[model samples]
Target: MSEFQKVVLSREITGVPVAQDFAIEAMARPEIAEGELLVKNAFLSLDPYIGSRLKGRHMSGPAPKIGELIPGLAVGEVLESRAAGFAPGDHVVGESGWRTHCVMDAAAAQKVDAAIQPLSLHLGVCGMPGLTAWASAHHLAKVREGDRVLVSSATGPVGGTVGQLARIKGATKVVGLAGSDTKCRTVEREYGFDLCINYKDADWTDQLAAALPDGITVYHDNVGGDVLDAALANLADYGRVILCGLISQYNLPEGERPAGPNPGVYILKRAQLSGLVVYDYMAEQADYAARAFEWIESGDLRYVEDRAEGLAATPELFAKLMHGDNVGKTVVALGNG
Candidate 1:
C-alpha cells in the first residue's frame, strides 16, 4: 500500500475522551530498513490503560505526547521483511499502536500461530490482556482452590479472564463487580462467575457484603477506587489483593482521583496487596499462550470481543471503553481476513 491511516493524539484529555482528542491522518507507508519487518495491522486493541497514557501519565515509561501515534497493541501480518525470522505472510503480534501499518524490528514482533486461534484473539484473550489476567491470578494473587474470589471491572477482558481462570483453578466461589445489571448478568451467566454485583446500584456495597458473607479471600482489582475500598473493608484475614488496572481513576484529574483502599486495612487484616504489570512476565508469554489456548479449545474458558470496524473508529471506541460501555475486550478491526 502506498498510504495508510493512523490515529494520533491531537490534544490532552482532562476528563473523558472525545473525537476532538484524536486525529485520523493519512500517511505514506514507512520504508523498511534492513532487519525490520513491515506489518499490516489487522486488529488494534482499545484498553483503559491507553486512557492514562493519553494524559501524559502511566505506571510504565514516558507517556505519549500530543501528535504522537496513540500507543496500543495489535495483531498484524508481515507484508515485507528484511528481518531474519519474519517473512511475508507471517502473522505477528506487537506494540503497533493505532495504525494500519508500522515497521517493527525483529525483537519487537513475535510470530503467532493464527491456526491456533483467530488473529484478533491475539490482541485480546490470547494477548496482553490475557497475559495480564494470568500473571495477576496465578502469580500475584496466588489464587487457590476453595478461595472466595472477587474481581472488579469483571465485565472487561482482564477481570473476566481472571474470574474464569480462578474458577478453573478450583476456587469455590467467584464473584464479580460490574457497572450495570446487564453486565452483572453477563458476567455471571456468560462468563460463569458464581455471582456478580451491579456497582452502579445504590446498595451495591451491601450486595457485595451479602455475596461474600465469609469475606473475600482473593481480590482481583481492576477498577481500583471506591470498589477497591469496598473490597478492603470485606477482606478476610490474610486475604490477597492483586492490584491490576485502576480504570476508575484513569480519566480523572490527578488531585481528583479517589483515595485508594485504606492502608490500615492491610495492617489490621494482615493482608497482602501486590501490583501487577503484564510486561513483567514477557519471558513466560509462550507458556501463558499455550495454556490459554488449551482452555479456550476445551470449552473451559470463553471470551468475548467488542469489535469496531475500520481504524478510524478507534477513538470513539476507546472513549466508550473508558466510560464503561464495552462488554468485554474491545478491538478495532482494520484489515480483511
Candidate 2:
C-alpha cells in the first residue's frame, strides 16, 4: 500500500471527547527496518484508558502530541518482517495505535495464537483488559472464598471480567454497579453477577446495601465518582479495594474531579486500597493466558465485544463508548482480518 489511514489527535480534549477532537488522515505506509516488523492492523481497541490519554491525564506515560496518532492497543497480522522470530501472516498484538498499519520493533509485539481465541479477543477480553481483571482481582484484591465483592462499570470488559472471576474464585456474593438498567441487566443475566445496581437510580445506594448486607470485602473499581464513594461506604473492615481504573473522572477537567472515598473511612475500616496497572505483571502474561484460556474453554469465563466496522468508524465508536453507549469491549475492525 502506498498510503494508509489513521486517526490523529487534532486538538486537546477539554471535557468529554467529541468527533471534532480527532482527524483521520492518509499517510504513507510505514517502512519496516531491520529488527522491526510492519503490522497490518485488523482490529483497534477503544478503551476507557485511551480517554485519559486524550485528555493528557493518563498515569502510564506522556500524552500524544496534537497531530500524532492516537495511542491504543490493537491486533494485527505481520505483513512484512525484517525481524527474527516473526514472519509474514503471524498474528500479533501490540500498541499499534489507531492506524491501518504500523512499523514496530519486534520486541514490542506479542505473537498470538488465534486458535486459542478470536484474533480480536487478543485486543479485548483475552488481552490487556482481561489480564488487568485477572491480576487486579486475583493478585491485588486477593479475592477469597466467602468474600463479598463489588465491581464498578459492570458491563465494561474489565469490570465484567472482574465480576465473573470473583465468582469463579468463590466469592460469597459479587455485585456490580452500572450506568443504566440495561447494563445492570446484562451484568446480572449474562455476566452472572449476584446483583447489579443502576447507579443512575435515585435509590442506588439503597439497592447496593440491600444486595450486600454483609458488606463488601473486595471492591474492584473502574468508575471513580459516586460509585467509588458508595463502595467505600460499604467496605468491610480490612477490606481490599483494587483500583484498576477511574473512567468516571477521566474526561473531566482536573479541578472538577470528585474527591472523597473519605480517608477517614479507609482508616476506620482499615481497608487496603491499591492501584493496578496491568503492565506491572507483564512477566506473568503467559501464565495468565494459560489460565484465562482454560476458563474460556471450560465455559467458566465469558466475554462480549461491541464491534464497529471500518477504520472510519473509530472516532464515533470511541465517542459512543465514552458515553456508555457500548455494551462491552469496543473494537473497530479495519478490514485486515
Candidate 3:
C-alpha cells in the first residue's frame, strides 16, 4: 500500500462551495480484489449535478453517507487489474467520484475510446450530455418536423446538443437561451440556433416570445425556476417539455424543495411535461452515442468545453457552473498528458 493525495469532503458548507469544504489530503491506496481494477484518474467532471450532493439530497442514492469524498464522474487509466478483457493502460469511464485514484469492479466501469475524444469528454458530450439530448428530444419531447423547439442553457453540454438534435429532426426553429451575450452569439452564429437570447436580461421573456411567434412546441429544459415559468407562459397547446434538470435549486438547503411549477399556462395549454434521469435510460446510452457520433461526423452536431487546469480547482469550477459563469461542459484536468 502507498500513500496518495486525494480530495475529501469537509464538514462545513456555506451558501456557495469553498476550497476548504473539499480538502485535499494524503490517503493509503485501496486494495484490489477479484473483478476489480486500480485506476489513476485523468480527468474529473465538474457539473451542476454535483450541487445536489452538497445539499444532501443527492438523488442518486442515499445522501452519500457523510464524510465521504464528494461524488462525481471521471475518466481514468487502468494501473493494475485482476479483471478479464482489461489490461494496464486501458482507459475507462465510471462513477469513481472526486478522487486521485480508485479501485472499482470491472462491472461498474465501461471501456472507452479515449483516443477519439479527450478523456474529459467521456463525462460530457460523448457521454451523459449526448445521451440526455438524444433521449429527451426523441423520446420525452417527441419533437416532429416543423416543430418550434426551445432549449435553455444553450451552450451547456446538455442544452447545446438538444438544439442541434432538434434541428436535425427537422424543426422549423430552434431558440436557445444562454446566460451571456457572448454565449448567445455563439449559440446562434456557431451552433446554428435560429435565435438566441440572454436569460440574464430583464426583457428576456419578451425576447423569447418574439423569437417564437407561433409558440414553443418542445422545450428541452436544463434550467428551472424563472426560466421554467417563462417557458410555461410561452408554450403552445399540447406542447411537450422535457424536464432534464433544475440547476437553479441544487444549492438550496436540506428539506427545502424548490417551488412547484406555475399552473396557469400549464392548465390552459394542457401541456405535457416529463422529468428524466439519464441513468434511467442507461440501457440505451450506447445507441444514443452511435447516433450522436453520426451527427457529429456529418457536421450536424457540435460541442464546446470549459476546461480548467487541475483537480484542486474542481470545487470552484463547479460553483462557477451553478452561477451560470461557464459556457459549456466544465472539466478539471489532472494529468500532464
Alpha-carbon local distance difference test for all models? 0.86, 0.86, 0.81
Alpha-carbon RMSD, each predicted model:
1.7, 1.7, 2.3
lDDT of 3 at 179: 87
* Poorest lDDT segment (10 consecutive residues) of candidate 1: 254-263
Q: Tell me which of candidates 2 and 3 scores higher on lDDT.
A: 2
State the local distance difference test value for candidate 3: 0.81
lDDT (10s digit) by residue, model 2, range 23-97: 889989788789899999989999988888776678756788889999988888899999999999998888888
Query: In model 1, which regions exceed 4 Å deviation?
Result: 1-3, 254-258
The collision pairs in model 2 are: none
How many clashes in each structure?
0, 0, 0
* lDDT, candidate 3, 230-280, per-residue tens: 988899999998998887777777777777675767889999989988887
When 1 and 3 are scored with lDDT, the better candidate is 1
> How high is the lDDT of residue 240 in model 2?
96
